[model samples]
Target chain A: MKVAVVKYNAGNVQSVIYALQRLGVNPLHTEDQQEIRTADKVIFPGQGEASSAMDYLRSKGLDQVLTSLTQPFLGICIGLQLMCRHSEEGDTDCLGIFDLEVKRFKVHQHGFKVPHMGWNRLETDNSQLFQAVENPFMYYVHSYYAEVGIETTGITDYILPFSGALQKDNYYAVQAHPEKSSDAGQTILTNFLNI
Target chain B: MLTKRIIPCLDIKNGRTVKGINFVSLVDAGDPVEQAAIYSDAGADELVFLDITATLENRKTLVELVRKVASKINIPFTVGGGISQKEHVSELLNAGADKVSVNSAAVRDPQLIDRLAASFGSQCIVVAIDSRYIEGHDIVHTHGGSRPTELETMAWAQEVERRGAGEILLTSMDHDGTKKGFACDLTRKMSTTLTIPVIASGGGGSAAHFEEVFNGGKADAALAASIFHFHEVDIMDLKKELQAANIPMRI
Candidate 1:
């Protein structure tokens, strides 16, 4: 399958490429609109702060490019948050593909860490990504979370229940790094690839 | 209701996983890619690969190695070592690294933290602080614990967060690889003070050690190397213990 990974100043693009490679797909990494438009599946992956990452995306006109994608698009971590309507990190404006807001977890009474790093159980009734995995735990490393809404396909809890994964028609976004997660992580990618 | 995270870090040199006590007296741990898969099966929360070599040969081969691991495993993986620039961070992230850690670089140019966080987004930037107990002062270590900086660990952590660091991987040089236990006081002090989540690294000998880091240290996550590599403790078993301890864990 031909996969197009959106390239920006953020991290985790190569890991997504490698993940595709294991599935026998050496996906092309590019910021080119034509290439991205023509690809079978497009993945927008990132690791970085929100506002500036979005700034780069806008500077490159990638924000517009991403918003125009018709094929199935998967956004990872920051990519997923950027796909939302807004974010609390750096007061960033994001692509409004999914009608969700990315908000920071406020300091709570439990005294839990804010970033919510490491592996957490993924609870979802949607079998598309969780197929054969049976609610497996996936790797995560983030401070901000996408507020739960209609498009949420998976849910994980930190200080509260947040959008671990969101799917709205052709656009699919996951706050977790499927490239970094294990078999269940691969399954989500495989499912997205198939979609 | 988030499941507590258990991380296993592997120090990679020339693509091989190596372990040492007190960050010295190195020994072979295993193949990094293989170990990563093992950790995946055992339900590790995430894996961290620190390219400690900083060598031409190792650096050249490390990206490809990371690609190999990312392709096979479904979990998130973070890479550290020799990262300083935006392009380097871009390259590593593009190479399948979920996050790229900035240590010495962040210390040298604090703006580099802002640059990276602004470029990649704070979620992608990690400020790894190696710290030690100064008789009366809280100090941060640099150059992989070979040099000391005047920056206080807690103060630096606050600055790191302000500078746009998404998270802090706090490793205690005094406790690292000591296998005695985590620096509870240090971790608690930072955990309580910093707004961001802290991954406590160093001095984990058993499942109990993980508990100490989580409960006593109040760490969001606990990271270790040798204990996991040598099978001194199993990831699933450890998580089970943590779960039984009434600490929420992903089973």
Candidate 2:
């Protein structure tokens, strides 16, 4: 299967590429519009600030290319946040694929970390991305979370319940890093590839 | 709910695992990549590879090792030990390290944290503090905890947080290698005081110790090297025990 991982100013896309490689799929890490559009599956993995990422995407014309893709597209971490309508990080506007707003996690209570790092369980709906994965623990490291909405397919509670996975039509986004989430994560990636 | 993490730290020297790993299943225990995969498969939440190589030439080998580990292992791993510059961090991250940790360099030039956090978001930058309690003071130590600094542990931790560090890897010199237990009081203090997660390192000897660190220490995560490397504690059993103890675990 041809998987094109969207390349931008984001960090950690290499890990996603490695994950795909481990699954026996040689994914193309590219910023070229044609390559991304032509791939069987497009994976948008991110690990950086939203505004700068959006700016890079806009500069490369990938913002438009990404929104127009019809194939099964998956977004991870910052990719998921950027898929939202807006993000409080740098007060940046996103691709508006999910029509949801990403809000920074605000917790004054003890034991509630801002980044929400490490392993957390996912309460998934019947989304194809989480086919075999039921409330399994996945790795999460983010300070902002997309508010749960109608399109929300997975919910995870840290400080409060937020969208862990979102599925709107062909676009699937997860706030956690599936590449780094071990077995359950590999299953999710395999599901995405098979789709 | 986010479960407590169990991290197995691997000491690297010139692209190979330094200490002898007693995993019977590993084809080459010295091979960092092989060791990493075993740990990941055995249910380690994350892995930290500390490169203790001294020469500049050997440091380049660390990046290559990171790339190989990233390609093979499915879990997130952080690379540390002698990472002092933004360029070094960029190389390691580009090679697919999930996070890069700064220790003595961060203590020397605190602005390095700000610069790194500015370039690459705070989520990827970990500030590892090696501290020792002396005369009713938790003093920060540098150069592998052999050298001491005037900076207080709590004050330095708070400063790192304010300067935009994502996580703090606190290794208590007092408790490290003792196998007695983690410095629960100090870890709890750091965990409660800081808004970011605190990874308690140093004195994890048994699964019960892990349970204590998570529940009593209030640590978000706990890291150990010898117990895991020497086959004294199994990650799966540890997680299960932690879960049975009402400490949230992935298993």
Stretches of candidate 2 above 4 Å error?
A: none
lDDT of 2 by residue, A21-138 (tens): 9999999989999999999999999888899999999999999999999999999999999999999999999999999999999986666889889888889976678888753889
Judged by DockQ cut-offs, is candidate 2 incorrect, acceptable, medium or high?
high
Error of 1 at B227 (Å): 1.8
For each candidate, what TM-score against the reference? 0.84, 0.98
Q: What is the DockQ of candidate 2?
A: 0.85
Which regions in candidate 1 have their CA more than 4 angstroms from the true location? A6-11, A30-39, A47-71, A82-95, A108-110, A127-129, B20-30, B82-88
Error of 2 at B49 (Å): 0.8
Per-candidate DockQ vs. reference: 0.57, 0.85
Best prediction by TM-score: 2
Second chain only: TM-score per model? 0.93, 0.99
Query: If candidate 2 were superposed on the true structure by all CA atoms, what would the RMSD be?
Result: 1.2
Candidate 1 chain A lDDT trough over 10 residues, lowest sum: A127-136
lDDT of 1 by residue, B1-251 (tens): 66768888988888877663221222333567767777777888778999998666666688788777876777776899978888778767666677788899889889999998766767678889998888888788889988899899888999999998977899988888789998888888888887777889989998888888888889888898888777788788998988999998877
Error of 1 at A150 (Å): 3.1
How much is the TM-score of the A chain of model 1? 0.95
